[model samples]
Target: MSSAPVIGVAVLLVKGETVLLGRRRSSVGHNTYALPGGHLEFGESFEECAVREVKEETGLDIKDIEFVTVTNDVFTEAAKPLHLVAVFMRAHLADPDQLPQNMEPEKCYGWDWYNWKNLPQPLFRPLETMLKNGFSPFSTELN
Candidate 1:
């Protein structure tokens, strides 16, 4: 395996007190709740990747994309050790009336809004690492 860590961009699609998340069916974090995001592509900015991934995965357009934080996630305990640099971003729906659809059913079960204070169990590692480090997506200042 390549020694370099992969860069992942995860968007915290905020709506009031809730954020958009879906049950992942991917190899990295199977059966875990994850934000709308994916691997960053060549020459792609973080904001661009967030928007593109959200649209491609959930069929929703996002705006106000801002960098929140980054996590160095090293999954050393996995059957195949993996390392990822997860860049977290905060954004909102471009249209409030728009709803998220399961655009890639093969990758996610479906999208849903969940209260940040009471998120679903078994969060994806990067997200779980963020929460454990006291990162909150709601406030004007990083929490």
Candidate 2:
């Protein structure tokens, strides 16, 4: 039996021309950095998923949610074939004073802000797809 692609909601929390990202330590995309996001739960809207995932992973409140872009990611290196439909969205921290914390240290190293032009190495595949397609949170341009 074939399974459908998993839908994930990735949040682009931009402030001061930088965005929030975390180094993942899980089975998928281990040691690679990606935006703070997670699998979209049932009965949740895109914006709702974005807010929940950020809060779950970074303990940060986000606002000004807006649609960005979607990337179809496919990975077959793992035991089971994995595919993801990543929904990218732009948002800002509701409280500027709140810093991103590694709410789940077991799953992530920590969170930090990085310039769009100077992202950390070994980015997650979905994020790479975003960049390859010219998706920049700093600018409203996406190709």
Candidate 3:
């Protein structure tokens, strides 16, 4: 038997002082806040997938993507194993005036921009750490 294939993508979209976050509406961790992203389709490159997912979920066009970190989340949901490889990327919006449009009404409740100094409670740990620690734009990637 073969191991499950690596899939999924996550993005860290930043403006000057705020980061974008979305409230998930589906999956095992529904209603939780997560970075904007989703699964990669066949024949799509990671970068292309990232752009597509971000647009589809958040309705924002990402420009100049810089690779960041990788997160592997595997857990038992209802006694079945779920494996995900999340490719985290740092991207800037083409137009800061634009706002996130909730396309998947049932899958994502809403979107918000939180200041780096005042992030909401119960945030996704890794993303919180990234904000608190001050990610360097000059850096290529994070381990």
Best by TM-score: 1
**Model 2 stretches with alpha carbons more than 4 Å out:** 141-143
Query: lDDT by residue for model 1 over 72-142, one digit each (tens)?
Result: 98887666778999999999999999999999999999999999899999999999999999889987797
Q: Flag regions of model 1 displaced more than 4 Å.
A: none
User: Against the hidden true structure, what lDDT does model 3 obtain?
Assistant: 0.73
Over the stretch 1-143, how does candidate 2's per-residue lDDT look in tens digits?
A: 13899999999899997999899998889999999999999999999999999999999999999988999988888667689899999999898999888899999999999988899999999999999997778775643
Minimum summed lDDT over a 10-residue window in model 3 is located at 134-143
How close is every model to the real structure, measured as TM-score?
Answer: 0.95, 0.95, 0.80
Q: Which residues of candidate 3, in runs, are more than 4 Å off?
A: 1-6, 124-143
Ranked by TM-score from best down, the candidates are 1, 2, 3
User: Which lDDT tens digits does candidate 3 get at residues 1-143?
Assistant: 21794577778788887778877766546666778887888998778987998888878898888778666666455244566666778889988788898877788878888776666666654454454556643354554
Clashes of 3: 0
The per-candidate count of clashes, in order, stands at 0, 0, 0
